[model samples]
Target: MKVIGKHLTVDMYGCSFDSLDNLEFIKTAMLEAVKEANMTLLNLSYHKFEPQGLTALALLAESHMSIHTYPELGYAAVDVFTCGDQSRPDKALAVLKSFLKPEKTKTTNIMRGDFGSQKDMKPRIKISIAPLRRVRNTSARVWSLLRKK
Candidate 1:
């Protein structure tokens, strides 16, 4: 099958609840996971919720990864999606699981944008163009182009 990307969704149970609540720890784990997967990180954002929860997102050149932790429940939901064949989402998950030390974990691997079955079919991309007006600002023209999408 022709696949564009791989997505691994993980449900970690019986993990270290305290570590899950630490934003810095979570960030470190995520970065280490991304590196283990051989994916390039474009940016990252993480937030610690009130009472006890944390959510961290990492934007990657191949795709993205995210981890949402429920410390009170000792569970964390993690997702790793990568478009590059060299980027191993499984390896990333392994790294994360090591850090979380979950006693029980469930994971699902999904193949995204598979198109090989339709051998005779070609994807059609449609784009409509409009006459450009007198736009002096460079940024305005870029915005206008993006608005078409």
Candidate 2:
């Protein structure tokens, strides 16, 4: 079996845009981003939210690219995620920022998937998480209460 995986995280802020109500413009931009990422697009869905703004999504074979626009506030939220090639998402994100003209942008990257990535991946028949602890001790309960806050 073979495994392939890549992870990327990008945070962008203070984006400047000409207008949010323009469906054609934003839709074009979204399509460009998907193509630039080298991902095959299966479908694209977009609509104007009205009063507030518009939300758009590009569904791709790798994953998805989405954006929310707030023209009134001169802001937008963008996300590009893929699993095959590591730099593809970031490259797409760069293209998006360049066109969107965001004032501020931050990015963090991390590997996604198991040790072998998607290779030999299978759904877990059983799930195991944190062991349930017996809550009889007063001090333990008090500690748990404090942690929750």
Candidate 3:
């Protein structure tokens, strides 16, 4: 089997509510994690939801990393995917864990771009009707209009 990249998905439970809800803290932690993992950051985006919760994403040269938090549930979901050996996705996850201080964590590692052989590969088809940005903008506009009523 040939592997091209590593993807780590983490589910953190019993995390600090304050830390999960803090947008600045999450942004800072993500930046630190990117640096620690030796990943080149191309862009970063984050949003804090009304009432609570937060979401952040970092676009890296190697790949991408993201975090979504539910403060009321004391949980955070994190994803780190990196191509090439120079970047450490595990190290990035570690940095997030340190900041959130979760009492329990469940992690899964997936090897990306791994295809054993022609016979072993299964054919699959995916279709997208609209770009993500367009969907998001439309949804936001609808939500805003509903809230104004």
RMSD of each: 15.8, 8.9, 15.0
The C-alpha TM-scores of every prediction are 0.76, 0.64, 0.77
Model 3 lDDT tens row, 1-149: 55888999999999988999999999999999999999999999998999999999999999999999999999999999999999999999989999999999999887788876334245557777679879999999999999999
lDDT of 2 by residue, 1-149 (tens): 33344545555566554555577878887777777777788899988875657888888788877888888777777777676653388677777777777777667554455666553354447654434344446669899999999
Reference-based lDDT, each prediction: 0.89, 0.70, 0.93
Tens digits of per-residue lDDT, candidate 1, 1-149, equal 77788888999999887888989989999999999999999999888899999999999999999999999999999999999688989989999989999999999877778776643345557664433343446669889999999
Which candidate, 2 or 3, has the higher TM-score? 3
In what order do the candidates fall by lDDT, top score first? 3, 1, 2
Clashes of 2: 1
Steric clash count of candidate 1: 0
For candidate 1, give the lDDT of residue 87: 91
Off by over 4 Å in 3: 117-149
Q: Tell me how far the alpha carbon of residue 137 in candidate 3 is from the true structure, in angstroms, after superposition.
A: 63
